[model samples]
Target: MAAQLSEIEVKGVKIPLIYEKSTLMPAVNLQIVFTHAGSITDEIPGLASLSARIFNEGTKTLGSVEFAKELENRAISLSVGSGNETLVFDMSALKSEYLEGLRLTRELLRQPNFTKEALSKVKTDIKASLLRKESDFDYVAQVELHRRLFEGTPLEYPSMGNRESIEKITLKEVEEFWKKRGVLRRAIVLVGGDVELEEVKKDLLSLLSVLPLGEEGELVRYEAKGDLEVKSVIKNTQQAYIYFGSPFSVKNLREDSYKAKVAAFVLGSSGFGSRMMEEIRVKRGLAYSAYWRISLSKSVNYSLGYLQTKLENEQQAIGVVRELIEEFLQKGITEKELEGAKQFLLGSEPLRNETLSQRLSSAFSAYYRGLPLDFAKEELHKIEALTLEEINAYIKEHQELLQLSFSVVTAPKE
Candidate 1:
């Protein structure tokens, strides 16, 4: 059974909580998700992610190293990371230490000591990481796809920001940025393990009430437009990275969204048996890995496919990908293929929720999207009842998949 999701109001803020008392293990997993607190809402590029990273450094009452020691001493694993739309602080520890976990969460969220010294060190580390990402062909390729696909929009830049932006950001600016955006006006807390509903709710309410209420902010939503074109960056490398996709708009729980998932799987996302992998990599020996993905954020949703090949065969590889997409559009998935894809997607749900952290994350995701606790199962049933005809019709309706914007990173020909 799914956890019972409830909401509590703390000083006019609505905080959502999940109660799951599964004695499956002796551990407790807590996920604290703050909506609209990630890169998607960045006033300054990378500020959302950078500010999130700074939270783990220490609180006003504890230094960075001591803070680290305390969490380690309790065998608690705490992580702070951000996606495009939300900031997440995930904690996993024994059921016996749940109170301490909540206390530490409160400390970090309420009194993060973003000292100049810590800020300087973090900036230096992130700058170095950004520098390294430049040499990563796959990373560069993925980022470039977003850059071109979402050009002139807020979503275009990488979450880490550019060197110029990071260089200009000051410690004072990050503190202010955090102050403005870090308020948990909508706190979605999920707890899974051996714990009572009332106990967890009380603990979360007290800790979360410390978060001040702030006004909501806006972010630029990206809408893809225009003709079929390939944007290539010339480099002096042997491998070429390519990604192509069309901008797709679908809501979280819409019927059409489920069909979209089936389409994605049949096209390329489904591993070695997928269309892109079979035709591009296995049949023709064109690329090493071929895959497609559908990314849905609160503001924007799109479907993209990626492959990497030798620089010599980059254009050929791109052409092949376009051809396969056209064929799939003209001739949608076969009955066998449809069933196989459905099984793969459905069966994969277990692995997705196999761990406590995974369950917490999924619950957080569901809550973030205003979905019910059993959304994954709900979608699985939807997928089970879908027909090939309906799926194909949806694909035909969105035939602009042929107009995928290709972003390629490869060396210029001699």
Candidate 2:
């Protein structure tokens, strides 16, 4: 079943609600999403992420362990996390324990465990995780790529922040960030599975009653740099980790999004059958696998892809990738490639919406992107009717993606 969209007013704030009722599973999942409150809005690198981490530490009154135990006793799952563009609180429980789950969520939001001890512990853990990632060449390359693409913007920083940034985060800053950003004005509530709309609105009112109507912030879209620069990191690894990105200029996000999907699939995102995989891996054996995708979002738009290969073949692999992309822009995809992409995308549509949560996520995404709730179905129709000429024209139009920049992690000169 599809998710339905509606609105509910609390404290004179109208919040959009996405809901789907299903009785097949005796459980429910709710997500409280805060827009323009994620890493993109962080004043200090990782403030949004640290704020989410603190929120997950449970209530001030109960503390982390006891608060977790209370939820564990009822087999409920609740978590808070931040991504590039939004912060989310997710909760899931059996229908019988839904209200109890909501109770804990409210408590967590109203009385977060923002104590000094919790802040120190979370910072230490994040630092340790960052230390471990030092050895992860893939992570190193990916971060470096973003650093180059969005050098002066908030997107340049890793979502989890760096060691220095995390160390500089104080408990007071996290508290301030949450108090200002986590407001009713920025929230969109999503509920699905075994619940009625009236019940959901009542539960949400009770859960959100504690939040203040803080000022809403505007989201700034960062442009990807198109300087065609190459940055390399010297590491002790035998295999080279190479990541690449460039500007994906789409003038209209909504009208061109479906065409971009089909183009992305045939060019790189569809794995073995895609252009990148066919040329880089199967054709020349440059790497075991390679991938690329068009990341179109509210805050940023770019093309990102990565691959790994032996140190000796790193330059050749990079050249082949560049040539492949240039050729793709020049010649576009074959009719066979277009048909294969359409078949796979259309055929796999069912699996994508097989669950209530998936449907809810889709509905929320539509709302977030300013599209109709039925956009998923409409997108399928567009994909099905897409012509080869139209797709090729779309591909040839975005030659800006050829201004590729590379981030490579490889061994030092022998």
Candidate 3:
């Protein structure tokens, strides 16, 4: 039987639940998020990501191979990934297999094996991936940009600890880290699709309640120092990948961040309609692709734009991008542009939460950020309410902070 969506209070914690009655085969998506445990503290820099990686490596009763085979045989999809401030574990399976899926998830969370063999495989894979990243121009540029921006903060370290760091990690260290940081006391488990609220809560509590509670700690804050400026490094390739931005904190703007986002979209985010696309692709054809994005963190915020073009035309592309940004900052986007960007945002918003998987993912994101469940929708409403004058005013306020950064990969001259 399919269950209806409802909110429930469990042991003083308010949990949001979503359920849909399906005529087709019953399917369920479950996401569990651990808050306050995902921080990149100086002591265990990559602890969150590492813990998530080792979750499925092995469990109490199942060895690595056996555990993997079990999920495959059951047609279960399980994923564990972490971000700056949250660690997430997601499971999707048919309702008929729901009990089995929950059992496996509980065992994996409570009793991960963290064997030496599994750790070795993870280390080897990470090292190979890092080597591959070295040859990627865009990757190199983005890594450098983060290093420069974050500087001394623990957040500066790559999510996948470097080769040296990963090599140093041992099974014992992983176990200790897991014990100290993997407590599910503050975790939120969301079950979507055909699921009974009581059943879901009962299952989660059975596994999560046994874990000992730990001291609640504050999230690490990273402060960006100095003025934003352009930095470049030369690499051997035919095209250049450029990135530009300045210090802009999303937390500071809150709901008002919509204006900044809309401005960015009008300026360079919209592939074809964006100003950068007009100048760099349509008018001059210096590059076939150009776009910009805004990245927000608890303590850090910045905008980045990039394009790829031949070595000879790289300089032209960079110049045009800079010029267009300068013009946008000075004059601001027109009323028509703002309207179009808002409509694009409004139309795109629904697609983001259209599916069970997406909604569950979004719920995790909200829990991670300490945002209201309706933050996405509210943000869209804010975007629709923004006026051209306000956006232009925002551009003027942020113009002086704009900094252009570039990384170019070019082929050697014949």
Candidate 4:
């Protein structure tokens, strides 16, 4: 029931295949992920996202509505989405409809609706979405945090792009970006559910043969800037939206990552019982909830957290956040906290792996992070045997996390 890794050779290029067979339902899911083709590689802000939207419009021959109807008739779901570091074409259909799904996927890839009409429609949709986000204080705060942390880097730009950026995007640019990024070289195939591996491999060879050979671009890694600066935005809001981040250097991902997980869980990730929630919410009454997350990936690494409180209590909440982080760095976590984190993380293993999609995602994460396919199983073993001293040592070593940068959005003085 575990996802396994294999490879298919097309045009002398090896494409990674991550798959798992599950007969629990008569359904299948597939995701063709392109590396180095996401927002990080965009020469123009939102080019990657814009290209994905056009791909979702179906083929040039069928047009959007008719193409969608064909898939709906077969009960197939096909879509393209972009992330910070990759673009994915995802499909799901019944076991019987899978062949039709493959044929449709090829059609989309070979003849994407890159016309002026499609570009105008997608641009209008994205611009409206961007306008709506202006009213979301949390979104505004998070975007500001990224801007301050990544300043000159690609990460600074919003993935969905501002209205101006979307307006500047054109059909020709979208076509070029898609043609350059969607290639045999960048593809990683993930297919599973109610199919044999041999049959899947044979079908994939034909489905992927249509992809043009493209030059792979380099994925640049960005580290959170340790500025210790507070940037405030004036918004007409009752509550102050606070977003905080700092650098978290992961020296050895495989050896020290489990410790980071436990440390992060004990510090801020676990709700109610976590140190951040216990101090900021339970004791000080600064906010209803507080949390923190450690994000480590091939393209970026950082510690991010957020909370909201009354505009009147804004400064006090920020101070409490700083004090808690400094205290955590100085004192590390207690044995009780460590034990609780371990118990919770270990006990929740089954829930995390209960479904086929979860298994596929876990496997993809392992491959994406340049770790072994069995890394998840091995990580559980490490967490179960981890010692308090070891986790504390790891926590104390990450002093860079305390160089916090704050992005606060609050109402103007009344």
The collision pairs in model 4 are: none
Query: lDDT for every model?
Result: 0.80, 0.91, 0.70, 0.91
- Report the C-alpha displacement of residue 69, candidate 1, in angstroms: 0.7
1 versus 3: better TM-score goes to: 1
Taking all chains together, the TM-score of candidate 2 against the true structure is: 0.99
Q: Give one digit per residue, the lDDT tens place, for model 3 in 1-414.
A: 322335545454554554443434588878776665663642545556666777767675787789899999999887787777667778889998988888788778777767777777777777889889888888777767666767778666777767677777777877776676565455666777676666776776665655556544577666544344556676677677775555654435455567777877888788899888888888888888888877666545677777888778866776777788778778998989988998899999889877766666665555446666656777888888888788898887765445655545456556
Q: Give one digit per residue, the lDDT tens place, for model 1 in 326-414.
A: 89888888999989988988998768987666666676667656777667778889899999888888777767667688888888778
User: How many steric clashes does model 3 contain?
Assistant: 2
Model 3, position 338, has a per-residue lDDT of 82
Candidates, ranked, lDDT: 2, 4, 1, 3
Model 3 CA lDDT for position 66: 92
Task: Predict model 1's lDDT versus the native.
Answer: 0.80
Give the Cα-based TM-score of candidate 4 against the true structure.
0.98
What C-alpha RMSD separates each model from the true structure?
1.8, 0.9, 3.2, 1.0
Sorting all predicted structures by TM-score, with the top scorer first, yields: 2, 4, 1, 3
Candidate 2: C-alpha lDDT: 0.91
Clashing pairs in 2: none
lDDT of 1 at 121: 79
- Residue 351, model 2: lDDT of 88
